[model samples]
Target: MHSLSAKDLTLGYGETVIIDGLDIEIPKGEITVLIGGNGCGKSTLLRSLARLLKPKSGNVLLNGEEIAKMKTKEIAKKLAILPQSPVTPEGLTVYELVKQGRHPHRSIMKQWTKEDEDAVQQALESTNILHLQDRAVDSLSGGQRQRAWIALTLAQQTDIILLDEPTTYLDMTHQIEILDLLFDLNEQKGHTVVMVLHDLNLASRYAHHMVAVKDKKIYAQGTPEDIITCELVHDVFQMKCNISCDPIFGTPVCVPHGKGRSVGANQKKRAAI
Candidate 1:
């Protein structure tokens, strides 16, 4: 199939290096979730893979060729990226936004074609947003807006897709819905899905391969069953947790030990006193 890799990657903002000398290979036709605590560079790493962020050192390779050396349109045809927060122009309808995904394949003279219309329509249908196609993106709720953007990415019809915290601002129901959609895309179409997810349980449920980022490096990488553990969660996230199997998906589920209003960490500490 397809291959994506980062070699000796050193990425960061100006004067701040987030990841240093890291190497990762995206497993073909698998869902890879990048898990880390806040400010651990999960989004930065995703952007680097999509070539949206320039690396401080090294390069991202697609199919063994340096992505930096490829033309922008060429890359767009093979891969797509959906950022965590995307700007939706005021008054722009959902259909218009999804239509933009076809720009990489269109020409000034070629304009609209059957293929473009089919792609946009398919994306809208796939996202269950077909009825909202005429609605202004700015007027939609947060969950609707997220789906519209996801539809745009699907319209690109790329083999590889990278998303950053796609479930942000979505309720639990919608979160599961979105993850289910991505899972279906991978199983049925063989799209190489790479993403950053904050929810530990959801990550474990949906990820075929999980990469735990710790100390700005890869702490572990493998199947969810192999990579997820009570020790890894505590080590990487610095949060005490118990690893259990998900009843529905048969995947690892992380149960965190936290102190809130009831008995937990704080109650235990007070009992010792």
Candidate 2:
């Protein structure tokens, strides 16, 4: 397993800085959720940490060495990152897409071997997509396609996985199902998992650790039960909210109270007036 650390990292685009002087240590073999309002640099930070974007200042360290110094293929062998919406090549079957994940470990002279085949098969089985291996990825539903992409990442066999909004296109049921699969991957296999999640409740439910981002930096980081509070929600999200223990999981759940006038409340008050 590998531990990820960002040290005084600065992230931005062109000349404007979005987040500066940020430092974070991701726990090994656990699910770490990053939550923040839009434009707060959650995605940028994840990209920087994943080595897809270089930090203007400071560095991201994998294990103990700086990531920027590592070769791309070397990094690919140890870490795999899935962006919010990975594009699927037209006509690519689920099996073909997943097989791409093994490229980092392959050589021209030494092509696909028994071990590579087994990895692909195990990845499909682990993600419960073995039966769909022959299906065209584009023909699958949003949830199934997402799982297929995830299976590809699993085929990489990396110790650290960074996922940006793994639940983006799915309905609530599929969101939970995908997250449950990820949870088992962490709990059962002990792979270090880090993801960006907009749903605070789901983050609390599935994540072993939470990092709240606000104003371009980590606002707070800890167990949901310890760091998720009414004030944190208000400050981080700019929304008043009530914090309560989740009914089933006992983790902190956020109930947002935003600026939009409640239609029902407005009607009731108008009738009273």
Candidate 3:
């Protein structure tokens, strides 16, 4: 069964609808990436799945139960969401921030226990931020800070994790690092990961299942090989592109046609000669 799904979900702000009557099911224990152009409702859809946004119509389901009816803490125990560019509280250490993830698991009558401590430690270790746990979150570099934030979600010990543009503002190296970390979490820990990503090539590289959002609905969704094509990219992103294969991963790669210098055919012939 899908651990997370949206049934006829309609989301918007005021009267401007962003997503209208959308249905999606996130495959359990896989990486699902939502891709689309700006203002195409990718983030809006993700937020609704996490119950961060209230839908105007339809329902979000978690393990076959309606998510809107579930208690906040109960939902927190099963799902963790890292929003886009989250603000770090001033002077908060990484350890302290990560520890906050345990709040859903804690109670007024319950004291901090070994289980909680272990969860926090494991989260830091999983994100490879154990060494920076004592450092202030604001002091870390972009990559380190992103990892620390991921550790916070990890500390929640949920089976499902959702993130909105987790790699935003990070350099290429850091983006790869963050995606690789999430890939490992899915492969090794069997966690269901869903995120909105802007990079088409990277999304194809890491996503086992990909959903392309366009025109307030899903344009297409499936494995990259099955759904990612020149037509889909042009239709969803409004760009012309060639679909190629990644040499290393064999995933579909989008080579967009845009203005750039071109090597003349004569130059290539002369160079070869």
Candidate 4:
């Protein structure tokens, strides 16, 4: 019932609009993946929805309320955003970093309440980082660091969570792990998750819904099973591919036909001939 939507939304930075007149709905209690080529405004649109960037025209609405009108703290209570490549403070412990998420909940009169402590604890535990709470964030591995950042965001306990490339520095294993964690969050907590992902396979595997962006507009948006067809990939990414069921999950799986191993195999066959 609490959907986030944009109506004729245009977004930009300092006089240049990167994306224009976008109408899209981020369905509640679902994991929505945003996929597009670099510079196609995937991150720009995510930031706009999160209210980190202002809209040039039109409005971004959360539960039928214009997001721009809500006070930052009030908005923070309902929304949390994890940007791409967030910078961690040197020597800052994992617990300390996660604790920052409570900023919106704190006031001059109510500094460190029991509720704050419980939130931080729950977030750390949820991320499986409770044991690493005292370790400096910089000392963690790339995957661990990513988990720490996710934990920080989880501590915010917002109904809507926006993640910009949550798997940037991670290996395949870690990427899947993070995606699984996100999927669980959506399934168990009913947190509406919206993320920008570069990996189409991962998006198809983990997302309940997908949005393909291209040419400053929505190329397509729907369930992965419905939207991740070969035509969509060819149109958005300009690549040929085969789309089939995932053996395990039955989600759409893209087999890119013109890149990597497939191209190598073709070239080797030609050379042999």
Best by lDDT: 3
lDDT of 3: 0.95
- Tens-place lDDT digits, model 2, residues 1-273: 777999999999999998899999999999999999999999999999889998999999998899999988899999999999999999999999999999889888986899999999999999999999999999999889999999989999999999999999799999998999999999889989999999999999998999998887889999999999989988888888889887888988888775777899999999999
Per-residue alpha-carbon lDDT of candidate 3 for residues 77-123, written as tens digits (9 for 90 to 100):
99999999999999999999999999999999999999999999999
Model 1 has an lDDT value of 0.92
Q: For every candidate structure, what is the RMSD over all alpha carbons to the true structure, in angstroms? A: 3.4, 2.7, 2.2, 2.5
Compared with the true structure, model 4 gives a TM-score of: 0.93
lDDT by residue for model 4 (216-241), tens: 89998888888888888888988898
- Candidate maximizing TM-score: 3
TM-score of 1: 0.93
lDDT of 4 at 253: 82
Write one digit per residue (lDDT tens) for candidate 1, span 28-73.
Answer: 9999999998999999999999999999999899999999999999
**Using Cα atoms with residue i matched to residue i, what is each candidate's TM-score against the true structure?**
0.93, 0.94, 0.96, 0.93
lDDT of 1 at 237: 88
The model with the greater TM-score, 2 or 3, is: 3
Question: Which RMSD does model 1 reach against the true structure?
Answer: 3.4
Better of 2 and 3 by lDDT: 3
